[model samples]
Target: MFNLAAKPFDYLIVGAGFAGAVLAERLAAGSGKRVLLVDRRPHIGGNAYDYYNDAGILVHRYGPHIFHTNAERIWKYLSRFTTWRPYEHRVLANINSKLLPIPINLTTINTLYKLNLSSEGMQVFLAQRAEEPETIRTAKDVVLAAVGRDLYEKFFEGYTRKQWGVDPSKLDKSVTARIPTRTNTDDRYFGDTYQAMPKCGYTRLFENMLDHPNIKVMVNTDYREIVKSFRHDRLIYTGPVDEFFDYRFGRLPYRSLSFRHVTLDRPQFQPTAVVNYPSTDVPYTRITEYKYLTGQTHDQTSISYETPCDEGDPYYPVPNPENAVLYKKYETLAAKTPGVWFAGRLATYRYYNMDQVVAQSLALYSQLSELDGSLAQDERTKQSIVA
Candidate 1:
């Protein structure tokens, strides 16, 4: 804990997640400035935190977070903290009592209908069944425009509904756009150039990132409680922008998730790390096996079942027209608020993947560095005038 009576920090970062941690590290290490980082949660790494369970297997507490990025800079920046384990994530959807490859690839289509369609044949088949909307507006439109109703119903519709607690037709197209339809037999979930996980786990990576002398971390401490006590030149807030403003423009809607973790006395449980239950009959959206993700050869394996809900910790920002309008108002307010900068998924009200969040944070750091340089130049100019 940092003493208030000590010299004031250069930055008071709220939320010890990626955004806050990245900024804290950059401001402290890069700029030689003091930074105090705090989080409401008791630990670091935010949702990406992983720990050894009773079964001695490493598992993500929030869910399975597989890091993949096309950005070389982002990948290189994170590599400083921890070594990498090359991992390509694959997902299987339980449809018609069979586990089929997700992303609606050629193999998925062929396996589903028992037709060995070539790549060209798969494209032709999709084209024949595709429905062109007048204007592609919603998640449903994105899918129907490519694969039509049958595949959409089987793969996305119910799973999306359960995941977001809303119908695909009501959500933004960006929601479904994340999942691509491959004409080829590529079964990998992400097509990024770099796909891997931290070899030691995400928590240790965060620990390395925050292990600088200039950084002071306080976990299980909310920023609101220390706002009056802590003294800092600027604020880097990574919490919900709506809540930070006290919901002056009304609360922004968010979809939360409940995770149920179970340990099984087996070496392996699932073929893949993740399996999606797209059927509406299933209560949970997906199940993630830890051994598959971590490559842990444990006698007992751990798995997590995700159940989406309206309450609990905010995970997904409800992406719809109405919510967008509301977030825009808050965004406008955020721009005018002095001494405070917002970044990350919650702060920006966008669904960002793990690597995307890191990229955003690194970008934010660059912006902050430029701003600081400009401020210092202005200060020097004023001193010259005074002289």
Candidate 2:
């Protein structure tokens, strides 16, 4: 809408997701700097983008983004933009013909095996079946060591293979380690202290965060297309690290996802928010019912079946030793590059949660604000929040 050459921006931030939006807000409002935020996609929220579907039911365009975090500061930082709807996410696994709680809880074990076991007995059952690995190395080991062969075959093996496009044994231990095994009947997906969603939705939350006059946002635009036009003091990149250098060390392997959204005539589709389909025979890994996440009462429910693929917008950086080594090469190049800073999951090549990304952007802002001699006042303001 305005002439790009007329004014120079204080920062050229690539990607209008959590990382970019947070920095743009901080630089503009905190240090009074002009920011140009750009995204290849036509929206600002990145993977967390949500909107009403054809059925008039709100749905996440990317997938189900359940916000949960243990860090109080991260929670407080995001809270400033949008009010939250208190929600604790719960997931179930659809194996055979029954629905069982995930994270391999006591209820899940008892239901799967048709054995009644108390919390203490549950531990004994698992302990007897668990095979302790002398060294835990890979994702398969993480599950095998915790639950042994039987549970691993049914619950984890196929699911991880389907999602990552590799056997769990070939992936990093951090992959399956993210999922926990419980002796208690507690079946909640995440055990974070704060679990909720933005009251107005993530897109609105981004709108509020980037509402500052100093931040100019342009969607459907790539940095390379306008790199020669707009002049800036610094660059903040949140895109894939490999692409930034034009894949010099070869493109780092990433896992992409495709969603098949189906709006049915029925009111409710599934019992819970998400139902994990761990069977490799099925193409989809999981099916999410949007009403459970949005809390919207609708006569027809919306369903999203997620299928992981190799071709699409990169959703996950493949976690393996080879890929990690390749990412390190790019990391080295990134450090050598001047006037550029890399942040967020894609740039760092770590599978970070949304709250973690927000925390990282906030930390970067603190670092930049200190360099600008504004940390002292900002620190005082930060401490005022009780949680």
Candidate 3:
């Protein structure tokens, strides 16, 4: 047996979230390398962590993480650990005392305008109102090109302002482009080929993934606390990129969220999984009912109210010209740093869905494996590596 105290660990993974957990499994089980996975939180699943509340209801601690993916390989990879429960996410936008399907679908438009129209008619109606932008450069531009100002104001403007702490016109097009407008009445939040959640919850899925003998886990301990004492050949960093470099190029802007969780003594609280409050009348951007996402039959329901703010744990990277330029500086610096690889949303300063994060970590592992010749060329890859 390999003694943990006698020799250096092969990989020291920071953050036991999706990026770190998936990569740690790949490195330890696939390559037979000793891995150390550490998280600042007292759990292994990171932000996707879920647990049973006082009422015995399963609730996501941070927010709802509904798994959806177009990549078949990714679905297959995660399926190895736990069985899945089919789940299709749906959202509603509360507008002017009306609850309508979001993504501005046909049902949403008809309900808002009180008109009966077919899919083709809906397309024509949108085309008649949408203004052709001279150049689509900003979030407001994208919104106006798809739907007119009236719809934009009702469904997007106030929410964007509250969520990002800025007007839509000042943000990057990628911000609004993430949300799709449908001509049809399909109200599903994501149109991926695979949509499901772990049968036992994300925490259990993570437990199965990190059960390898070669992988060790430490929680409630920041990497900085144990990094100096622990000897590791390579490092996988999944934290904020700016902090790693000590904000030398100045702090990159990020939007954080404040979540308020409550377990109500009722069978259900909302009609659907999530309801978006685009109006500025409310402080929160959205409210999520975990029972809908998890499909748990419980007398008491658990929900989370999300308030986006400038403070708290960074949840979203603010996308704009200035922030992009700042992130590039950190990226360049990371490339030069030896034996360290940055992965995940915060580390790369990009907003990625849970599936995308998993795909990225898998791709990174492949690159490392092929380039390092099964880690025989570890000394060389350590110096020139850029992930």
Best-performing candidate as measured by lDDT: 3
Residues 1-387 of candidate 1 have per-residue lDDT tens digits of 545577988899998888889889888889998998999899998999999988788999999999999999999899999999889999999998899999889999999999999999999999999999999999999999999999999999999999998899999999998889999989999999999989999999999999998899999998989977878899989988899999999999988889999999887788999999999998999999988777778788899999999999888799999999999999999999999999999999989988888888888988999999999999999999999
Which number leads on TM-score?
1
The CA lDDT of each predicted structure is 0.92, 0.92, 0.93
- Expressed as tens digits, the lDDT of each residue in 1-387 for candidate 3 is 446797789899999999999999999989888999999888989789999988888999988899999999999999999999999999999999899999889999999999998999999999989977899999999999999999999999999999999999999999999899999999999999999999999999999999998998999989998998889989999999999999998998989889999988889898999999999999999999998988899888989999999988888899999899999999999999999999999999988999999999999999878856855667667777863
Q: Native-vs-model 2 lDDT?
A: 0.92
lDDT of 1 at 148: 90
The worst-scoring run of ten residues by lDDT in candidate 2 lies at: 1-10
lDDT measured at residue 267 in model 1 versus the true structure, 0 to 100:
77
Off by over 4 Å in 1: 1-4
Steric collisions counted per model? 0, 0, 0
Q: What is the lDDT of residue 119 in candidate 2?
A: 88
Which of the two, 1 or 3, has more TM-score?
1
CA error at residue 81 for candidate 1, angstroms: 0.4
The true-versus-predicted C-alpha distance at residue 352 of model 1, in Å, is 1.0
